[model samples]
Target: MSDPLVIAVDSSTSATKAVVVDKSGQVLSTGKADIDLLTPGMDMYEHDPVQWWESTETAISQACAALSDADRQRIKALCITHQRESFALVDEDGGALRPAILWLDSRAGDEIKEYGSDHIHELSGKPADTTPALYKIAWLKKHEPEVLTSAHKLVDVHAYLAHHLVGRWVSAVGSADTLNLLDIANVDYSDELLDIAGVTREQMAELAQSASIIDTIKKELTDSWGIPGDVVLVAGVGDGQAAGLGTSAIDEDVAYVNIG
Candidate 1:
């Protein structure tokens, strides 16, 4: 039997990249697709949420195209590492209600100042910074009340992509943690935080632990990729956490820095 293979994806702010790797972690093929950044106003950055899934599909298809039939059949799983704190509100069928808000968007500065405090920092383990999705969601609640109240779900990049991959709404704990809606100690969503964002638990994705197998990729996706066997989907973390893991920076004494 051939060695098992996995597809690893990094859906960053600028692009989506995919790599096919064997059990030994040797990358056999790779591909990439760019995402257009949308700026509608000062300090407002966004992306068409549809582009997220479309780019992912394109990148993965390109990567898997380089593999042989046997190699494709050997593929057993898929995992995603994505930009943290970016999010979108979607309807029940996963259609984006609007463009996804990017992490770098600073439009929520006012909300941050109003809501940032020791209590929030203690609950989220994230400083009172512009990066978390919490403040931006609050901004929406204040200014775009109709958009927030009518949306069926609010999801991070991981949950959005996972829905396209597996036909389910789920996100890894580490991935969702960057949203500042999680209770850091419990590694789960907090009611207090959700209430502050004007969303409910029903609006969140079902959480899964990082690195665990979540579910098999949709049959249509595998068929389109020319992969004959079931390819399980693995829960993933935010790109920052993935970077640490990629660099072997797990130990307390080690630190990883990205100059870029």
Candidate 2:
């Protein structure tokens, strides 16, 4: 038997990148697929939502295809790090209800001004900023009430991809925190935060601790990709935190700055 391998996927604003690596973090192979960014109106950035999963599949399949049968069998798990704050409303079967709002979207200015305050900042541990999903969700509540009320779940990138990979509606705590809905201290969804966005706890993805194994990837997906059928899906953090780990910036003296 050879050393085990894993797939690390970064689903970002522009593309999804898949890299196969050994236990020592050596890059064995890589693949990428772009995600179309839609600018339907001034200050609005959106994605078709379905493209999130599609691009991921394309990228991962391409990466796995480069490996020999032995290398493929060595693959044991996969994890995803994605753009923070981007999210979509989906039905029970994971169908998108509308275009997903991206982190850079600025259409929620009015809602941010009206609802942004010290109390919210204290609870969420994030200032009333354009990057958080809370304001955008409030925008939807006011402008698209039916869509808000009808959604079965409001999911960030981690939850959305995790569901398709593992057949569970789950998100990593670190990934979901960017939505500005979690109580920072409790590290769980907050009622006041959900109420402001017209959502309920039941409508949120089940939370998993970051770096933990949430569930196994579906055997059908693994079989199709020619990887091990028992490949598990590991819960992951947002891109910002992931970068820190990648750069070995875990100490108090070192800091990682991403200009891009």
Alpha-carbon deviation at 211 in model 2, angstroms = 1.0
Q: Against the true structure, candidate 1 has what lDDT?
A: 0.94
Residue 212 of model 1 has an lDDT of: 93
Candidate 2 RMSD to the correct structure: 1.1
> What residue runs in model 1 are displaced by over 4 Å at the alpha carbon?
none
Candidate 2, residue 133: CA error in Å?
Answer: 0.3
Winning candidate number (TM-score): 1
Write down the worst ten-residue block by lDDT for model 2: 226-235
- Candidate 1 per-residue lDDT, tens place, 83-191, comes to 9999999999999998999999999999989999999999999888889999999999999989998898999999999999988899999899999999999988999
